[model samples]
Target: MKKFTLSFLLIIVGFINAQAQDFQGMAVYESKTSTSDLKSRFEGNKDITPEMRKMIEDRMKGMFEKTFILNFDKITSTYKEEEKLDAPGQQQSQFGGGVKMMASMMGGGGTFYKNIKDKNYVVDKEFMGKEFLVKDSLPKLNWKMESETRQIGGYNCFKATAVRPVSKSDLRNIKFKNDKKDAAKTESKEKTTSIMEELEMPENITITAWYTPEIPVSQGPENYWGLPGLILEANDGKTTILCSKIVLNPKDKAVIKAPTNGKVISQKEYDETVVKKMEEIRKMNSGRNGNGMPMRMP
Candidate 1:
């Protein structure tokens, strides 16, 4: 009698919800992964059309998303690209290559994760053949973080914004000449020209993080969010994450927790370290294009 009553009430509630001015629909994320011929290593140096830049941006965005299903509680992520591309029976797509170009961009294959404490927190991304784990440099919230309210995945979310100062390491690797030098030095400094000093890493860098306080998890995609519920969007000034699909109240139970063990450091410390290291590497390879430039090896 109790179970029947509960079911009846739920059905009536569903009917009422159906009329609540909005239809309850799950978020659905769709993507079509394709491949093209592998161009020469200087592919980025040549002139870029708007279409090409969009393609690269799409692929970069795709790297942050996972196809795995998640409910209100327990969640898991799996990368289907490897199996789809690496399967022995798969047919070649471009120039007799059966592998996924995106996978190769990363190195071999990749994985994704969520912070146990913050279900919305996500680490950095890795790629196809590379084994080294890449993690998002933690946000130095010393600047500012402001928020707004919005609805996503059938829930209310608070959107926020922040300014992320470029770490010195990132600055060093940004490819700019130190100072004008002799002809002999100029050849080695082709990559580090001084023309880029005027550039600043864009501002407002919107991070549309969603939080409901109902879930209380601090994780989001790619070190982006840690609000109350879940974050469905996090855009730097240039890139963004928007939820296309969502699921709630699954039949299975979920166990939420936090993640540890990463390159934990103060934002300032990370900047100093990365900047110092980048400077060292750049100077060492200045005269050794033989090893500095990209090349295929057996």
Candidate 2:
């Protein structure tokens, strides 16, 4: 009887080991961002009409709520946005032209593939129907461990924090177009500018992340990684991404692969391309406006 019990325990342990050896999992992340603080900063501006504010708010609301999937193995992972239906009567076309232009200028969705073993990554993006494959090294994050811990999705996670200094050029919402009409209408040049524009210099931002060691994998949604375990939640002041569901050793083997259908370019090259393309677009729009300067929503 004792021998039979020991044999059963050994079999169970072997099975668990085999499963760990071939571990493949998928994690679903729900992201939410609050624009209330940002909205409050510009809510009192007179140049921004209520209708315009509503449109901007709606666009920001959509930007904040998103769903993403992370398909991962022991060393590699691919993160992408899941296709979702728009809210009732809130289609993209319904937004104002300025909102649409801003969205385009901000760029669209992207697929990120990371390989911890290789210490590299690739991002797939589309611009004006042209596809681009951005290749670069994995982002290095210096994390400071904390004593705080929490439970996320049934897994006990530990807290880690980091501070990243970003330049003004890296921010998408910092630039405000110089509209001649706006310049003439208001007394203070700064007050007449787009309320959303950033007037101060760039500064460092704090990032907080929670990771679980049970997963024993260097993977997370988007570009977040680099802890002793899998990241279950991450907050970077403006946005928060949390893992809501996890499926371990899925029935169907997820083929973790990098994207290949695009013109391959280095990350720097892609940034330059986007800058040049946007400049051309600005020039064309200015010519059409007949003032050699495009008027943007304040």
Candidate 3:
């Protein structure tokens, strides 16, 4: 009887261990981007009144402040924006469509899935009313673990840093160049004004991440992962994503799966398509007024 009881206890312990190994969790993160640079661009511009500048800033705030949920298990995870109702009267603004387009370009609303075990990712991106499934290898970040430590959501987290290349097409890199001298010269010569231009972006920007070993999962918000533990916070200069709450092994488990519906394409192909489409639009809009009337050129 003693031998039988010992064997039964061993089996029970083994079953519990197996269940523990299949750990799953859901993390809620809040992401925000700095608008200081955008505000500065509006300064000293006489054409934009104070109220107009405030309106623009408010719209930018709405676009950049968002909440995302990350559902993860051992090797795969899905990160997506948590939908929220727009403010009263805010949805009808003329800038709403443009802002949404810009946000989509910056990876704002999408179902992003990462499979660490397969070293690949699939992103469902919607741009200009077109859906695309971007499949590609996972971005590899050479993270240098730092000795620094901090607590996030009651979990001890360690710091890791890496440098990532900046995307030239990112709207954040655009700057309004109010070159009065150049504008005067252009108007005099070409009968047009140039008030905005894209700023040259650096080759790379540094990224800082905080991960907690307590979770023991290689998952994070957006496209960040491959850390020694679960990433709870990450910052890339302009934007910061931080975990607000985490549910470990919740009763209602989330389905962590890759999105399948969309026009299949690689990441490189998708970017090239966006660039080409933008170029076509720019060409179509050149020398045209806001009402779509062609401007008289000297």
Candidate 4:
């Protein structure tokens, strides 16, 4: 009878503990890529006309619809836990007109995760004379976070920010010229120079995340966290990412994995590879004669 009683008590305790745990929420990531902002024109001379630019956009869009695929099976997992305590009068007293008070998450208001992928950007990594094929991985770009605060759902939440900048490196390494886009015009030094200079990072992306200490989890979606309340918004300077619907803790389990389709190289290797590739492409431009063009995109 004692053994049975102990088992029943244990079961009750487990159930209570589970109920006291946080809500398993859905993690969503919103990022903005400047692929739509700028235009690349390739003319017979130093630049491409607007008409040429239009053709290029249409062509690339088709290619993206085909080869540039984004898969979400690579990165998607984080932990958010919130806690609370019952007031004696509210939770225990049968006739008391009181309510259980809640504690913050993170510290009282949030959750945090180590490395979560906001976007499933598969990279074809080639570094240090070795090339990695391609995989769904979180490509590390410029991500910055700041200590700011805001209010949501009547909760005074502390805020954190993250920023990511686009580098002109991709244009240098990857020749988007392909088979259709006149390779001759694409190889022009003046044209390449103009394109590269124009693609410089326009602004730093700022992501504001809120968290509370009630939950003691240092994890969030896409490797974002460290605030005093729930992160309701993550902005990349241009687009604002708001949590439309969130759950505290769910009954089912989550799964997360790193991508293996892209290459893996150290920071140094990436830099060198990009630099070398840029120089090669620049030198290969036969039209501009290495004179370089204006930094602004026409």
* Candidate that would win on lDDT: 3
TM-score of each: 0.44, 0.73, 0.84, 0.43
Model 1, CA-based lDDT: 0.41
The regions of model 3 sitting more than 4 angstroms off are: 1-17, 168-196, 293-298
In what order do the candidates fall by lDDT, top score first?
3, 2, 1, 4
| Backbone Cα, N, C clashes tallied per candidate | 35, 0, 0, 61
User: What root-mean-square deviation over C-alphas does model 1 reach?
Assistant: 10.2
Model 2 alpha-carbon drift over 4 Å, by segment: 1-18, 41-55, 87-108, 165-204, 276-298
Native-referenced Cα lDDT, model 3:
0.80
Q: List the lowest-lDDT window of 10 residues for candidate 4.
A: 98-107
Candidate 1 least-lDDT 10 residues: 32-41
- By TM-score, the best candidate is 3
1-298 per-residue lDDT for model 1 (tens digits): 9999999999999987665323221223322222222222125655666666555544434443334322223232211222233335333323223124333332122333443433233233222222223344346443233456777666777756555554343321122233445545654655663322322333223334455554444445434443544556655433344556665543443443233344444435544543454344445555564556432211
Q: Give per-residue CA lDDT, model 4, range 19-128, as digits (tens).
A: 54423445443323333333333433346567656555553332222111111111234333223333343334332211111011001112222344254322334332
Error of 1 at 190 (Å): 4.0
State the TM-score for model 2. Answer: 0.73
Using TM-score as the measure, name the better of candidate 1 and candidate 3: 3
